[model samples]
Target: MAGRALLVFLALTILSSSVLLPKARGNSEGDALNALRRSLTDPDNVLQSWDPNLVNPCTWFHITCNRDNHVTRVDLGNSNLSGHLVPELGKLEHLQYLELYKNNIQGTIPAELGNLKSLISLDLYNNNISGTIPPSLGNLKSLTRLNDNQLHGPIPRVLAGISSLKVV
Candidate 1:
């Protein structure tokens, strides 16, 4: 009888952990996206679907996720979004494309963006963004675009090291 009870307890523990583990991982990405939602002034309500109470940001509009539910892209270009970018965006480890062009977004690029090892394209052109481009962006090995923003200061020499880079 005791053996049966022990088996049941173990099964319950495993079951609960399996269910909660995914939510825990999704929460990090969701929390990061929610931070961005809070920072932006979405006049068009493009971010209306960004509800933090949801299980994950994968269900949110403008956010793309992989099979594992990790955010892989953020397609918010020309959506009339304004407001400075939050550093919390750097938490998206699988982010590939960050399209926020043609908006009124201001403030300097967060240096923490260098943490996105999987980033491919980072489009922030035609915005009101100002300040020196963060040199840490040099860390993106697959970056294709880094142009047309209001940034000043000598382009980071490190960016020249990346062969995938097209326009800087």
Candidate 2:
């Protein structure tokens, strides 16, 4: 009952945000963020500021963008969030840091995240996530940090392919 209502509320909010974006600075990044926002169950309303109508997501809270308006970081650690991670996050070409630790996120890490060649850090510790670590993670050539999770299966040898990888 309550859960269903929450879902409805989230859907309505996103719908409202979508309707406003066309008249604002809407772009692909905003779309990606919208996907991410949709995937999350934000009970604290921390993501309320993530308005897709903005042409640049850089101005949104917990999101950092470069001077070129490219999203570089997403610091959403420990905000009492819960939900599955969407594959749309893989679209942040210039993203360097993706900190999503200490939440209740579940599901597999999307293989598409391997596309984040510019990523330097991916912190997902202390979560309820399951499934094997994606072997595609070996593609993060610049990755230096990876930490605690509830993953199963063998660690991919390709992960060794990342010369800069330090933590696992």
Candidate 3:
């Protein structure tokens, strides 16, 4: 009888773990953004209002969320943010819109940002960012709006194939 009970307990533990693991992974999305925030040097204090302690980034300034409570938009245009874009920004798997235009951001556009498969619009215009636009950005098949920036490189042919692309 004790053996049977032990087996049942083990089964229950496995069941519970399987149910909880996805939630834990999903929570990491926000944790990843928080990590990215910590990496940035927010000199202009524009990101001062960002409080990671707050329940969700969606509730933070210039952020938006979808019905699933995942971050969908980040509009930090003209905020004078001066820093490097962290690769951790790629962890936002559900991000659809990212607007960081007209800032003092300087650095290579993170290749990891191409991991945002759900992204539809990305506006990085007028920033000081430099480097070759990642060929990985071609993976953003959902992208419809890509704006001008200081990006350098021969345009990737994959980007040219995007049926939804309008401007780059």
**1-168 in candidate 3: lDDT tens per residue?**
999999999999999888866653245666766776676666667666667566567667677888878898888888777777888889889899889888877888888889999999888888888888888999999888777777788888889878999988
By TM-score, the best candidate is: 1
User: Each prediction's TM-score against the native?
Assistant: 0.86, 0.83, 0.80
In model 2, which regions exceed 4 Å deviation?
Answer: 1-26
lDDT of 2 by residue, 1-168 (tens): 999999999999999887855664448777887898999999999999998777688889999999989889999999999998888999999999999999999998999899898999999999988899898889999999888999989999999888898899
Best by lDDT: 1
Off by over 4 Å in 3: 1-26
In candidate 1, how many Å is residue 142 off?
0.5
Per-model tally of clashing residue pairs: 0, 2, 0
Residue 10, model 3, lDDT:
99
Between candidates 2 and 3, the one scoring higher on lDDT is: 2
lDDT (0 to 1) per candidate: 0.91, 0.90, 0.81
Q: On a 0 to 100 scale, what is the lDDT of residue 58 in model 2? A: 80
Of the candidates numbered 2 and 3, which has the greater TM-score value? 2
For residue 128, give model 2's deviation from the true position in Å: 1.0
